[model samples]
Target: MSHFDIFIGEVTGTALLILLGGGVVAGVVLKRSKAHNAGWVAISLGWGFAVMVGAYLSSGVSGAHLNPAVTLGLAIEGGTKWSDVPLYIGSQMLGAMIGALLVWVVYMGQFKAHLTDPEILAAQPEKEGLVDQKAAPAAGPVLGVFSTGPEVRNALQNALTEIVATFVLVISILTQGLNNEGDGLGPLGVLITAFLVVGIGLSLGGPTGYAINPARDLGPRIVHALLPLPNKGGSDWGYAWIPVVAPLIGGALAGGYYNWVFA
Candidate 1:
């Protein structure tokens, strides 16, 4: 693919990815939305489907490496050009921002309703014990609908969780060729990877929200900080680096392990 194809493919695919993924968050988090209180299972499945759709949409062109971690892993494995890394990552970020912006547009009503009605906090629907991020103490300083936060306030544990989960994810991508299909993970690999995301979320998302992808968290967090939603609090800029840096390190480490043992 030419630079244009790579850029366009990733941008469009990633945009759709975040559009639906963030859309799910808004659906469940916003006070007025029907999907409010749909719970974590819904979130995990929604994100998985988002990845599947995004990857399938761009597979022929950019191979749909929508996550910067995936791009980095492939690049380290000699599949993608190092020169193209920045462009791929930049497009993904831009696409994510666009998608998150669209979510705000789609759910503008719910946002106003949630923010304007301070009583919604007391009216929170029951969860089966899952943390309600929008509630007191747990909500911290920011709304999680636009980004991620830890249920527990430990930075090291949060970063480590991201690192370990992302390490599994990138390693899975690197070895997806060895699956039933054959080498290169075909169209089926997108599905597999999407399921992998769900598995990571279901098993490992309790601490942090399992931000296995850098652009996924960062772009929407930026949008949250810039958007003019009523009473929206801090962006939690202090902990932003963990989601971005840990994923890169984890991806690189996975790629190195793949080269050493699996190559």
Candidate 2:
């Protein structure tokens, strides 16, 4: 694919990925929505469908690497060129931010109602375990709709969770999802990958919400920090690096392992 095609494809695909993925969380969590409290099954399947839709839309154009971790793995696995890595990651981040912004737009009324509700505002800090106030609350009510956070505060465990989950995801893609040319996923691969995502979310998402994609987490978190949502607590900068760094480490290790053992 040409550079322009790669850029447009990644941006559009990643945007759709986050749009539907985050939209599900918003629909389930935000007040005044029909799907509010629809539960985890809906979330997991929504994200799975989100990945499938995004991948199918962009695979023919740029191999539909909607995640930076996948792009990094593809590059290391010799499917994607090193020179193109920056474009892939940058487009993914931009697309993620755009998708998050769209979610806020779509759920504007619900967000306003949820955040402005007197009971929610009063109970927020306590729910986030910030009453003692050692640092900023790591999460807020709607933050999960945009980004991820751990249910527990153990850094080592959280990092390991993200690393292992991401490792599984990248390795699965490397092993079974790549096309013949190694540039991207084929039709079957995309279907398998989408279900793989749902499985990961169902099996391993509890601890840290399974942020196997750096762009998926960070770009939306950046938007969360910037947006003027009432009572939206800190962006959890303290925990942000783990999701970003650990996934890259996992992706790189998957690539190296594929080269060493599977090649």
Candidate 3:
């Protein structure tokens, strides 16, 4: 595929990724929504499907590394050219940002309505009671927005989880692609990979939400911070570092391991 074709594919893939993944979060987290409280299983599987669609659409052109971690891992695996890695990652991140921005806009009305509702405020008795006594201030509206920052926890464990998840994803992709090299497994390979991704999310995503893609986590996290909302909280910059750093580490490690294992 030409560079332009690859670029278009990358952007489209990333946008689809954020639309599906972030959309699920908005569904579950937003108050009175249809998907609210559906929990992680729904989110994980939803993302898996998103990845499947994105990959199938773009894989022919750009190889569909919608995540920076995936792109970096592929470069290390020798499937991607080193010279193209930077551009691929940049496009992926931009695409992710665009996707997230769209989600923010789509949900803005709901968010605003929720924030201004007096009933919503009255419903939270613990918070309302504290505020009435002036012992605690009413929390800001941004509190409802989803975030990517890590909570206080073991940094090593968080990093380890990212590494393991990415490892599984990258390794599976490489192996499957290799197995189907001659037969041109095409879209079916993407579907199978998506299933693996969902499995990883369900089994191992508890710790850090399985942010195997750095762009997937950071891009949306950045959107949550930048978008105007009634009462947003801190972007959790301290914890944000973990997802960014860990996924790269995991991807690189997986790439290196793939090299060693197959060499």
Candidate 4:
């Protein structure tokens, strides 16, 4: 595929990813939503299916790695070209941002409605009653729209969970690619991998919100900050570094370990 084709694929794939993934978050966290209270199972399956579809759409040209962790891992494994790494990673991040922007727009009406309702805001005691809390106000109309807070210890645990989850993801991708002689992985494999990701998030992600993809977490977090929403605060910039830094470290370790074991 040409460079332009790869760019387009990455953009579309990332948009779909954030659309489904972020959409599910909105559904669950947002109050008065149809899918609210759907539970972790719903989120896991939603993200898993989203990944499967995104992979099917972009895998033909760009290998559909929507996550930077995957891209970094593939580069380390020597499956992807080093020269192309920058473009791929940049495209993936841009795509994610764009996708998140779309979700923000799509849900804007809901946000506005929630903001207009005094009762809705009052219902969230944590944000409503706090006088000078350290954390920022919620991003969207609903409480905890884009804000994720964990205790100090839980934060570390969540970070560790992401590392292990990413490790499994990278190792699985490498193993599957090596075993398959076909031109590309089939849809079933994509679906199964998606399931695994969701399972990781549902089972292990409770602590830190399962930020398996650095770009996935940070990109949307940026959107939450920039987009016009009532009571929007500092975007949780303090903890933002953890997701970006940890995922890369985890992915690198996984890739290096996989290469060492396989070689």
Q: By TM-score, who's the top model here?
A: 2
Q: Which sections of candidate 3 miss by over 4 Å? A: 116-152, 178-185
Count of backbone clashes, every candidate in sequence: 0, 0, 4, 0
Which pairs of residues collide in model 2? none
The model with the greater TM-score, 1 or 2, is 2
Q: Give me the overall lDDT of model 1.
A: 0.82
**Cα lDDT computed for each candidate against the true fold:** 0.82, 0.90, 0.73, 0.71
Over the stretch 1-263, how does candidate 1's per-residue lDDT look in tens digits?
A: 67888889889999999998888888888768999899999999999999998888887777788989878888887777888899999999999899899999999888888877857544433321354334333332225777787777677898889989999999999887633111234688888999998999899988889888999999999998889987665677777888898898889888888889999
Model 1, residue 165: C-alpha shift (Å): 0.4
**Can you write out model 3's per-residue Cα lDDT over 179-226, one digit (the tens) per residue?**
311121277788898898899989988877788887887777777777
The per-residue C-alpha lDDT of model 2 at residue 183 equals: 58
Give per-model CA RMSD. 4.3, 1.6, 4.7, 3.1
Model 1: number of backbone collisions: 0
Per-candidate TM equals 0.90, 0.96, 0.85, 0.87
> Across residues 214-260, which tens digit of lDDT does each residue of candidate 4 receive?
87877777777777777544566666776777787788887798889
Worst 10 residues of 4 by lDDT: 135-144
Return the TM-score for candidate 4, rounded to 2 decimals: 0.87
Ranking by TM-score: 2, 1, 4, 3
Candidate 1 lDDT for residue 142: 29
